[model samples]
Target chain A: MTADRGRNRRTAALLISGGVLLALFLVSLTLGRYPVPLWDVVRILWHRFWALFGLSTPVVWTDAMEIAVISVRLPRVVMACLVGCSLSAAGATFQGVFRNPMASPDILGASSGAAFGAALAILLGCSARFVTIFAFLGAILTVALVFLISARAPGLRVVNLILAGIMVGSLFSAGTSYLKLVADPANQLPAITYWLLGSLSGTRLASILPAAIPMALGLVPLLLLRWRLNLLSLGDSEARALGVNTDLLRAVLILCATLVTAASISVSGVIGWVGLVIPHLSRKLVGSDNRALLPCSMLTGAAFLLLVDDVSRNLLATEIPIGILTAVIGAPFFIYLLLRKEKTL
Target chain B: MKKTIALLLAAMMLIALVGCTKTPNAPDAAGTRSFTDSVGRTVEVPNEITKVAISGPLAQIVVFALCPDRLVGIAQKWDKTAERFLATEYYQLPELGQLYGGKGEMNLETLLSSGAQVVIDVGEPKGSIREDLDALSEQTGIPFVHITATIGTMGEAYQKLGELLNMPEEAEALATYCDAQYARITEIAERVDKANLLYITGDKGLNVIARDSYHAEIIDLLGNNLAVVDSPSSKGTGNEVDMESLLLWDPDVILFAPDSVYASVGSDPLWSELKAIRNGTYYEVPMGPYNWMGFPPSVQRILGMLWMAKLLYPDAADYDLYAEAAAYFRLFYHCELSEADYDALVRNSVGKQ
Candidate 1:
């Protein structure tokens, strides 16, 4: 009876958070340096939405308002949500699979590898498209290299994979440092450093749309197998005894997790704490049944990051890097959560 | 098999050592001459320096202005835009990279092969810089000289560099020009009411040159920099501000960096709300060979001063901007700016009449 009550409460919490996220997204569209009235913002969005399907509505607002709402702000808000959702989801999965509370999406060296690729591309004077492509490739390749090394050396223990990931992550981080060292200090070095810090300032619909495909492809499989993730969280021998093909399940999870992580970092640069903190925050609200935890973390992360990004761009005359604000806000909130209640996974 | 492999490696190591030690054949260094550098370090340089390498871009600009012929290796590769202003001979100089501003892949082998007698660095020194430079000098067997050059002290720095390079006539002329420009600006600064200005950079128009930053020296001297924060940061980019703060500040004029939001800012609805933008007092800083505004905060800022003075108060500081720009280009860049070139450079840059 109590278990039923808990499930009911979790469902309620999810619905509330989801509603909050949607409300925040709508509010964000109205807020910017250019003040578009609430009604005007709604009208502009409604007109654009209908216009997409070969329909025309009366154009009430100016082209500038339409551009600001549709072009400038929409992509940034969407990218923030997608990145937040992917990072949090990946973080939860990695922690569940590894049976370690501390594992983030970048446990497999994805963030570091992506950073190296982006830095190298910038150093070579490549365009933004090439930088994103290189970042994605760097992340996927680093994880692949990690899996290859761990498989070759010895038993496929989770610890072995984690250790290999650390080694590979360090190597790519060093490569990024070298690129920063060689870049033109006036233009390229600052570009690389700012990129590493992560901002959504230059986001466009063109960049956001391409990255969404990979994120969805990675996310769907995880959502489907979320129930089975509970079984995998058990020790390997125990999971196998319980009729779970631990090896196959682990491989699939790692692949999906890596894809989402690489794609997220590729678009947003290295936004750190959402993946690490959001899962913990979700777990505190809803107990760790991968079924409930995964979706809850996703919604929470999306809202959390959207709010942080809004503050980051709006709080000052200069847009603070989203990564810096995430750590600053997340780290303190995480500590408060820790002090409020001590729970072991 | 292992023994054979070890032997091969040893032989390769020996060859590499020999290759590195074979110094380029140049006129034998005249008996060493000792001179005190700006940082109070007395270092022995070759008495007759026929060739030289710069440690970074700041040094490259200063050295290039005085003696382009003597520069054996450039700190950076010249792009096509830079090449347009520079002489054809300077276009092909070997790129040795740099050791400062986080761009630290100074190719020692290339510097050595270029046959440069000494490496010259011109900038503010920081955090055991003397020791660091000394160590680098010892490692490369090339004497490194550090010369301090702030906006205020650039004239003196030029004079000192001239004495070191034995190009008193060229250095004196450049130094005199710098001093005269500085004096001219300071004189006019006293007479005119300073305009409230904010210098912004970055693609999103968030980065601000805060009051009293090293990069804001010219802005401070010429105008009232309104982006005042309690503690200013000197990182890769300038300090960041939000639209709310910018709206509150409402600067009378806004100067955009060359690679910043200057292109798209006019179309930006929020940016267009700014008094500077609405009044069309916003201007993109000009760049040909280098940014006229001191991005690196070098001697090039003298031109920025003249340009800003005219841009701010056209009536009070009445000088033929084109004539001054042409003279500056000829003197510092060693390129003649034709009327067409000047028009192209200043196109869409002047405030809307």
Candidate 2:
């Protein structure tokens, strides 16, 4: 009876957060430095919906209003939700696979490698699109290197992976610093620093739409395999006795998580704290079961980032990089979570 | 006893004479004159300024233009493109680094050792500039002077620079040119129909110079700047903006910064939706040794003003573009600009013919 009650509560938490996320998305679409009437936002979206089905409607709203709603706010809000959800879900998956609460999506050097690649692109004076592409490739390459070293080494696979990740991550970080040292201090160095701090101010529909494909590819697998994540969270020997292929499952799960992480960071820049703090926050809301924790983290993260991004772009006319807002908000909320008296995860 | 007294007296006289002898590269106390800088700080500057150092790129360009031979070390090295219009010897001057920018601080050791008499800071004065320069001067034992030069004040800045450098005639010529050009731009700006203008920058062309920002001085003067935001960024990168903002601002005319999305925006489906791009009103800012607009916000901006005025109001600004550009190149860069040179410079900006 208790287990059933626990399940019901978890389901309710999921629905509540999911509903909150949808509400936040709608609200975020209406907010920007450029003011559009809420009615116009709704009208423009409705008109576009019908237009997609080969219907022409009279446009009551000005062209600027339509463009602001469809072109600017919609893509930015959507990208924020996508990035936030991916990072948090990836973080939860990493923690479960490693059975370490401290593990984050970038534990395997994804963020550092992406940062290094972006610095190199900036140094070379590559365009924004190339910089995004380079960062994504850099992340994938770093994770692949970690796996290669772990698989070849004559030691415990998990331990080897962790150690290898640290070593590779450091190497990429050093490379990024060197690029910064050589970058044109007037322009390129600041560009690299801004990218490191992260921002969604530059998101275009064209850029985010292509990136969504890879994010979806990674996110779907993690959702389908989340139940197995519970078994994997158990000790390796115990999981083996239960007939789960611990090695193969761990590899597949990690690859998907890295993919999600890489895609999230490549477009948005290196946003920290969300992957680390949001999963823990999710654990507090829902019980520690992977089934409840992963989805809850995803829904909560989407809402959390959307709210922060809205503040980032609107708090000042000049963009305060979204990464900065996350750290400032994420750090304080984490302190409150730590002080609370509760059953620990 | 008399010999001992005579010897002691001679030795004392010798020591006094040695102290009076001038130190190499040291300013004679008598040679320095009290000169009031832009911020009202009275500085003792050398009378016959033979060797000058720059605190940043702004000063480097202004000083190099006024008295190229007197420059001891350039604050920043000119890019390879500078070789086309600038003399090889001038462009290859010792790079002593900048004082206030993100890249490298002014190397005091280098400036002092190079035997430069004074280090000049140019352009608009920051809030603490007087104190900053004062502190730097006190720390390094090198005298520093700042000359305030906004788009409207270039003539005064040039005059102040001339007096400090002791080249009154050359300074007067440049100053007169500046004053005349300012009047012409004012005339053009007054007569021209206001076109809603947006200055787009960055690799992705997602950045904009907000209205009234330092980088947009020329744009604001020549056109109706439309990128007004709550807080304008002081940085050269301007503010990061999205395409939606551009569409909403709906500027009829657009200026793309060099090395931005100008080369690709023509083919991009999303960019083509913009009124400026679709109407062919967007043009890349002309760049060579330096951007023709106001990134440095220095002497080049005078040229940038003329070029911008011409682009905005061709009828009121009906003076020959090539003739004006040739005169500027000859005076500032000391390089003769042939018809081919003039054509090549504006090729990407104005497009062929």
Candidate 3:
């Protein structure tokens, strides 16, 4: 009876979080430098939705207003939501698979590798598309290299993988530093520095579309296997005794997590703390059942990043890098969580 | 064993003697004159200042204007395209890199070897900057002098530099030109309604020069800077902004930095929605030997002032931009702009609409 009550409460929490995410998304669409009245925003969105289904409607607002809402603001908000969802899900998976509370989405050097690739592309004067492609390739290659190295090592698979990630991450970071050193100080160096700090300032529908496919492909599998993930989080010996193929499941989870992380980083540079902090915050509310925890993390992360992005883009005329804002907000919240847990103990 | 130890000691002594005697020859300091520089440091500079090394790009530009011949080394090598606009003597000079802006790979060995008597830094000083420069001066034994110059104070800076270089006549000519141009702009600025202007920079042109930023001093004087953030960022790249904010500001005129999206912004659908672009008041800042606008914000900005004045109010500021540009190139860069060169530099850039 108590188990039934617990499940009911978890379901209620998940529904509530999802509702909050939807509300934030709608609020984000309405809020921007361009002051579109809420009614106008709703009308514009309603007209566009009908147009997508081959229906015609009279346009009431100016073309600039339409473009500002549909083209400029919509894509960035969507990208934020997508990135937030992917990072949070990946972070939860990594923490569960590793049986470590501290593991983030970049546990296997994906963020550093993606950063190096983007910097290199900018240094070479590649176009925006090539930069994203190179970043994606760099991430996958680094993860593959880490896996290969760790597989060769004999003992303590999880620890070996983490150590390998550190080695590979450091090497790529050093490479990025070298590129920054040689980049032209006037133009190229500033470009590289700003890109590294991470912003969604220049995102377009075209840029966001390419990353969306991979992210969706990665997310579906994660959602389907979430129940199995809970069992895998148990000790390997116990999970093996329970007839769970821990090795195969772990491999699949890692691959899905990498795909999501790399694709997200390619579109939105390395936004830290979301992937690391959001999952813990979700676990606090939903308890550690992966079925409940994973979905809750995804919703909470989307809402958190959306709110932060609104602040980043609208706090002043100048946009603050979203990574800096997340760290500023996340670090303090994390400390608060720790203090609260100690009080409970 | 005793013989080997004695031989080793003799070799070490010989090596030490050779090292001690191989120090690069310093210019004789017998006729040094102590002068209070812009930063109020009493630096003992050479009485007949000949060879000089720049501490960074700003210093390089200022020194280049006054005495291009005396520059022992440049902070960075000029672009090949800029070679035609510069003197041939400066083409072969070593690139000594720089000391500031986080690009610090200053080649001390090359600086010393090039026979530079002193290092000159131009611009406002930051925290503990005096101590830092003093330490560098003491370590390298090359007297360092700092001269602070803004858009308003170029004339005084030139006079000080002229006195130091013993070329008061040349300095007076440049200084007079700068003061007159600045005064004219200030007067015109007060009379006219300042055009709401936005300066966009960076690869994507999303970065904005917020109001009251050091980089946008020229913009501030000429127009009403539209990017009015609460706390203005001091970074060279300025602050980043989104398209929504840009649409909200809806500036009257937009100036694109040389390295920004000047080439593609005209056709960009979202950018075309801007009122400035729609009205054709947007322009790409002219670039040649150096950017005429605010890169380094040196004496070159005199030309920027003249160009902007003409571009903004064609009837009010009646001076021919071509003639002014030709004169600036000849005086500052020591290269005459031919009819073709002048056309190419300002082509589709200034007053195009």
lDDT comparing candidate 2 with the true structure? 0.81
**TM-score of predicted structure 1:** 0.54
List model 3 lDDT by residue over B1-353, tens digit each: 99996777667556645643444333345678887877778888879889988877777777888899888878767766678888688776777766642113353334544557778888765444565566556544567788888878888889988987889999999899888889988888778878898988899899888898767788888889999988666556777899999999999999888889878877889999999898888888888777888676677888888888788877778789999989888888888899899888887577564
Error of 3 at A132 (Å): 0.9
User: Chain A structural similarity (TM-score) per candidate?
Assistant: 0.98, 0.97, 0.97
Instruction: Report the lDDT tens digits of candidate 3 across residue range A75-154.
Output: 77898999999999999999999999899999999999999998888777665667779889999999999999998999
Task: Output the lDDT of residue B238, model 3.
Answer: 79
Chain A TM-score for model 1, please? 0.98
Candidate 1 CAPRI level: incorrect
lDDT of 1: 0.81
Clash pairs, model 2 backbone: B98-B106
Task: Give TM per candidate.
Answer: 0.54, 0.54, 0.54
Q: lDDT by residue for model 1 over A176-248, one digit each (tens)?
A: 9978755645556766887888777656666787989999999999999999999988789999999999989
Output the lDDT of residue A197, model 3. 72
Please give, as one word, the docking class of candidate 2: incorrect
